[model samples]
Every structure is written in C-alpha cells, then in structure tokens.
Target: MSFLACRVFEKTESEKTESEKTSPKVQKTTIYHQLVQMETDELTAGDVLIRVDYSSINYKDALAASGRGKIMKQFPLNAGIDLAGVIVESDNDAYQAGDKVLVNGCGIGEQYDGGLAQYARVKSDWVIKIPEAYDTRQAMIIGTAGFTAALAIHRMQVNDQKPEMGPIVVTGASGGVGSIAVNLLSKLGYEVIALTSRKSMHDYLFELGANKVVSEDKLGMSDKPLGKALFGGAIDNIGGKTLSNIIAHTQLWGNVASIGLAQSPNLEAKVFPFILRGVSLLGISSTNCPMPLRTKLWHQFGKELPLPDFEAIVSKEIALEDVSPYFDELIDKKHHGRLIVNCQ
Candidate 1:
C-alpha cells in the first residue's frame, strides 16, 4: 500500500580540494523537502513495519525542514524524530503484529528512514512498547522532548541535585522541552524559574508552573568567569553566552543540564564554575541513548513524571501535509510548546 510521507532531499554542488578550501567557491549543500506518496516497499529495510499514528515536531525537525542545520545524515529520508504507532508486522519474535510501539531517535530520522509517514519501517531493536497508561497521541506528546528532559533530571539527581539546593532554571521556557521541564520540575517539588527571551510568553510560562519568569534582556547576566550564585542548577536549551552565564551563576555543587543550542553551540566561558563551584555540565543525548535506560525513562513517564499538564503543553496538531509551515515558525521564534503531526 502507498502512504503519505515528508521526504527530505539534499542537493550538492561540485566540491573544492584543499588548495581551493579558502575560496568561497567550495562545495555546498541545499536541502529540499516535500510530502509524497511512498509505497511500503520503498521504505528502508527493517524488521518492524509500523502504522504510525502520531508524530511530534521538535526544534530538530524544524532544523530538518528549514535546511538551517545538518539534521538528516541521509537525504531522501523521512523527517521526524519522534513517532507513536502500532506494529503492522514484525520480523523479530520479540514483537508480534499489532503491538503498540513508539520510537525516538535511534538514528531513525537521521541515518535511517523516520516516522513522518503514515507507515514506517524500523528496526525491531529501536522500538519500545507503548506504555499502558497512554495511547499513541499521548505517547507522541511526551515524545523525544520529554524523554530528554527526563534524562537530564535523572542524571542531575544521580549526581545529587535536589529541590532544597535552590530554584532550577529552565531556559527557552516556553518551548516544547522547556515547557515540559518546568512542569515536571515543579510537580516534583523543585522551584522552577522559567527564562525566555520572548516577553509575550510570561503568562504561559507562569501557567505552566514556573515559580518566576525572567526575561533574558532584563537579566543582564554577566560574561565574567564567576558571577553571583543565583540558581541551584539549570536545564539550558539556548546555549552560547546564555549557557556560559548560567554556568557562572549556578550554585555550588549544582548540575546544569545542556540540551539544545538555539542561541549558539560555542561555549566560550571560563572554567571558574567547574573548578571552584563544583558545577557539572551534563550533556543530554536522546538520539542514541542505550535501550535499557531509554525504556526505563519512557516507563517512568507514565508513573513518576506523571506530567499532568501535558495537554496544556501542545502548541498545535496538524496533518502530515501541513507540517512544513510550522518549521519556519519554530526557527523564527514565533512558535512555542509542542506541535504534533497526525500521520494517519
């Protein structure tokens, strides 16, 4: 059967050798994306074939759609990092046909075919059974974004981070991951400080359980090696000077979980926070997280993390054909919260 999918293609130009490397006339790549009908056999070879029910948009997916970042490692592949569905068939004995499953990362949207289609074929090893407490849509709502947030919290707690330490700052506080992080942290009893550059989102952030909302421009954070200790720790989405500033201002022995680099990836700050304050910068990589820990975290979402305000976190839900426009919205900073896609 044929199904609809958003396929991303990469166009390349002639390459220049070492001698011409300095020239602006070097190799260049252009990205193109669109929705098309794809036959089941056209999918990449995999042990499990899933009828995708729901998928979600993330900054990473926006990167894929906008051609701004090198998100998809392979061209002409589907473009979604998270999906929830039921198995249509399975080659592995561990999963039978009709099993409910979900997938996040595992190189699906990057290296292999992904979940932007009405149907998907993926490795059996990459699949996780849908939690009993949630259906496909709810699973996608908590998709990769929530998964990464959980990872950050898990790692921070493992290193002894506590609510008693101080308020936990969540940068990019109105976006998908940040919104969920604020809710989860507050629900878990930590004081949550929502930090965002957008002045318009303060009320929304407050409604999401932020103890306080701080505007980036007003904060006037310093670029010094060490600043006044403000927060106990942070879950930072916007990187660059913001991350550096957060690092400088974090309390002693706190953990700063670095997730996204919306501002910039370069960290050009001093090591005073690390050396003097015992602050730890935890890197969260949801793409290739080990299956054991990944499954455990997904399981915890239905229980400990609970995420009672999940419905409030959804920014919009669209069909596969309408997925392209929201990418630009995300890159332009005109969108906040999660955007889910209904593949079927």
Candidate 2:
C-alpha cells in the first residue's frame, strides 16, 4: 500500500536519517477521504484501481478517519483498513476489470491511501479475490474484525484449545472483534461468556450465542494479583487491568489471545499464571500478519465463520459524508458491533 505523497523531499542526508530515526514523516493536505470530489491525480501508482462499494468503521478507523488519534503515521494519509468492492481497472494479469475483491490491513489505512475514498489504487498483492460465498456489502460487514477473530481462533486451535476444554470468555463483547469471537466460539460449540460494560447489550450478546453475559466490572475485582480460575480460554479486546485480571483468573493450560487495547496499554500481572498454570498470552497483530496466514484465515472467514445473521452485528450504516459524527460516539463507547460505510 502506498501513502499519498505530500512532502518536498528536501532534507539533508543527516537530517533525513535523524528524521527516520525519530519519527515517521507526516504532511498536511486537504485530501478528504469522506464525500469529497475526486481529482484525477489522486490515484496512487498500482496495478488495480477499485471503486469501493463498502468500508467499515473499526475503532482504529474511527481514530484515523475522524482525525481523533494520530494514527496517520504518514500523511496526506487515507484512513481505512477494511474495504470490499469491484475492480474498475486492472493492469495485473491475475485480476481483470469487473472482478470483485476485498482488502483489509497491510497498511491500507495507516500509511497508504485507503478504502474510505471512492477510488483506491493498490498493489495486486494486497487484493483478495472476493470469496464466491459473499458479496461486497456482506464482506464489509465482516471486515477486519471478523478476519482477526478468525485468526485468533485459528491460533487457539493450533495451540490445542477445543470446545470440550471449557468455557471461552470474550471481552468487549458488543464490539466488532469480541462479537465475532463470541459467535464463532459459540458456533464451534464452546460455552461462550461475553464480558461487556454495557448492560443494555445483555440480550443482544445472548442472541449472538453467548451462554452468559457478565459485566466487565465482575472481571475488575480488587487487585489480588491472582484470582480463582474462571475461564478455560479468552479473547481479550480491552487490555490493561481487565486483561491482567483475566490472566489471573484463567484455567490451567488456558490461552488468552490479546488482540486490542481499548482500555489501557499497561498490563499488571503476577508471573504465577504462566509459571504455575502454564497459561499462554498470545499477542495477535493482524496488520503485519504474513500473507499466507492472512489468506488462509480469510478463506476460513468466508467458509466456516459465517454467523447465523451477521446483519444483526451491523448496528448502523452511514454514508461517507456522515461518518465524522460517529467518531465521538465510538470514543465514548456509545455504539455496538460493526458500523459499515457505504461509499457509493
């Protein structure tokens, strides 16, 4: 993925090295990814240019798309990690015009020009031919969260976690990653427990196949450093104290997959869980995950990760023009599940 070029490239060699050592470069530009007129010169050099049909608002997207966090490691940056659309033009032999494809991660949102706009020119390697089982709009509904969820589950299975072991807990249950994890774990026959701070989502979580829905505060007990064993395994979205607490309470030989940090970055935990119980804390970084693994996981998402009604997770849909207002809502934890953006 290529970032929109905004710098003049005039620094001395020493200054350039120092800058590279210190921080990634950023530049200011008026290139709006939201409901703005497209200019001919805006397309990046690539083998494929897609006219996006759908893109979803992940927590990171809200941070980058709405200019909340400095997630634009490079600027004049386009900010979206997940996109599904049709190929309007292609120069690569592997793809032709009119083919449907979807792309998530691989720096599309963070540094490269991304899917939030009506047009995206990306390398052929970054595109995945759309799975025959789904369409563009449906793919965006699953998007990056679903893809990452699949990867986490795959890792757990590879580590020998099976449904017969015991219950699996998913934190931030109402959000994209946690919700998909809940449904996937449930479908795979693990007794599923959803941890959410929003009391209003109790019923909704159950609808997604969570056998029990518990308050996040229940996991936030007084810091005893270790607690009674509770979950057999877990997929954690909120890190910090909640994750530390989960680590303390995980069953013997249980694994905890750390996928996000919506709460706090710091993790405070005693080493007893790993030493005594052999608990595994697997760190999941989906962005730079190798291509072969990414392809396998996405294929799984298309074939086996289908929920009973994925549309249920789609709480709201917004036009490209209206996405900015939702950023504050996301930061305040006022919404649930996935928010798809129809870019038309």
Candidate 3:
C-alpha cells in the first residue's frame, strides 16, 4: 500500500532537465521537499513497521526539511526525527503487533526514512515500547525535545547535582528543549532561572514554573577565571559566551549539561570552574544515544518526568499536509513552543 510522506530529496540531472522542460523559467531547487506517496518496499531497510500516529517538528527536522542546515546525510528520505505509534509488524520477538512504540534519533531522519509519514519502518533496536504513562500523542508532544531535556537532567543528577546546591539556570529557555527543561526542573524541586534572549518570553517561561526569568542583557557575567557562584548548575542550550559565563558562575561541585549550540559553538573560558570548583560539564547526546539509556529516558518520561502542561508546551499541531511551510517559522525563530505533526 502507498502512504503519504513528506519526502526530502535532491533532483537528479535528468529530473531537473525534465523539470526545466516542463517550466522554461525554472530548473529545480538544490534540495526539495514535498508530500509524496511511497510504498513499504521503497522505505529504508528495517525490521519493525510502525503505523505512525504522531511526530514532532524539531530543530533538526526543520533544518533538514528547509535545507537551511547540513543535517541530512542522505537524500530521498522523510524528515521528522521523532515518532510515536503502534507497532504493526516486527521480525524480532521482543515486539509484536499492536504494541505502542516511539523512536527518536538513531539516524532515522538523516540516514534513513523517518517519522514524517503516516507509516514508518524502523530498526527494532530503535523502537521503545511506549510506557503506559504516555499515549502516542503525549509521546510526540515530548518528542526528541523532551528526551534531550530528560537526558540532561538525569546526567546532572547522576553527577551529584542537587536542588540544595543552588538554582539551576536554563539557557535558551524559550526553545522546545529549554521550555520543557524549565517545566520539568521546576517540578523536580530545583529553583529554575530561565534565560531567554527575548524579553517577551519571560512571562511564558515563568508560566512554565521558572522561579526567575532573565535575559542575557540583564545578567552581567564576569571576565574573571571563576565568577561569583550565582547558580548551582545550568542546562545550557545556546553555547559560546553564554556557556562560558554559565560555567564561570556555577557553584562548587555543580554539574552543567551542554545540550545545544544555538547561539554559537565556540567557547573561550578559563579552567577554574572545572579545576577549582569541581564542576562537571556533561555532554548530552540524544541522537546517537545507546538503546538501553534511550529506553530508560523514555520510561522516565512516563514516570518522574510527566509534563502535565504538555498542552502549554505544545503550541500547535498540524496535519502532515501542512508540514513544509512551518519550517520557515522554526527557521525564523518566531515560535516558542513545540509543534507536533498529526500523521494520521
């Protein structure tokens, strides 16, 4: 059976020539995306087939679909990075028909066919049985964004971070991962200082349970090797000076989780935070995360990390047909909440 998918591909010379033949004014775009019908046989090789109920639009998904970032490793693939649904078929005994499952990262969107379709075929190893705490829709609501947040927090705690150590400031607190991190961290009993570059999102961040909402302009970071310990720890999404400053201000024995480099990837800072303060900088890699830990984090989503305000965090839901135009919204940074795609 053929199903509709948001397919991303590069036009071959023949295809482009054929296109120019049809429309004399234009040849073809370098990277193109559209809704197209595809059969299971055309899907990338995998052992498990999933009837995808929902998938979320993430930063990487937007980047891949819009061709604004060099994220896709192959052409002729679907573009969503995370999905939740029910298993329809599985070659492995560990899974059976009708079991709820979710998949994020593991190279599905970039190197293989991904979740931006009504149906998906993925490696059995990439599948996680959705815990009862979250249905398919809820799973996509959290999606890859929440998975990264949970992994960051988990790592921080494992590194001996505690609420009593001091407040945890979340950088880039207006984005998907940052917003969810704010909500979850506040609920987890840590004092959360949400940092956003936009002053308009301060109220929204506070609504997500941030004890304090701040912007970089409001905070004066020091040039000293180790600045005043204003925070116990930090979950930094935007790297560069912000990351360096966060590292400088983090209290003794604190843990800092570096999740993204939205602002800049460069870092110029002294080693005092790490050497003198005994700070731990944990690198959270959700994409290529091992299956065992991935499953554990997803399970934690159903348990301790449940987001009652997922509705607030999930700003919009669009049909699969409406996926393309929305990438520009993400690209322009006009959106603050998560956007989930209803593949059904």
Which lDDT values do the candidates have, in the order given?
0.89, 0.80, 0.89
Candidates arranged by lDDT, highest first: 3, 1, 2
lDDT tens digits, residue span 97-166, model 3: 9999999999988999999999999999899998888799999889999999999999998888999999
Query: Candidate 1 at residue 81, lDDT?
Result: 89
Q: Stretches of candidate 3 above 4 Å error?
A: 12-29
**Model 2 lDDT per residue over 1-344, tens place:** 33221111112222344567678655434323344455535655678988888888889877775555667666565567888999988889899899999989988877677777777878888898887777898888888988888888888888988787678889989999988899888888899989998889999999999999999666544566667887889999999988998888888889899998888988998999999889999988888888888877777664666543578888999886677677668877888988888887
Per-residue lDDT of 101-163 in model 1, one digit per residue for the tens?
999989988888888889999998899998788889988888899888889999999999999
User: Which residue window of length 10 is worst by lDDT in model 3?
Assistant: 12-21
Candidates in order, TM-scores: namely 0.94, 0.88, 0.93
Query: Least accurate stretch of 10 residues (summed lDDT) in model 1?
Result: 18-27
Point out the worst 10-residue segment of candidate 2 by lDDT. 3-12
Best by TM-score: 1
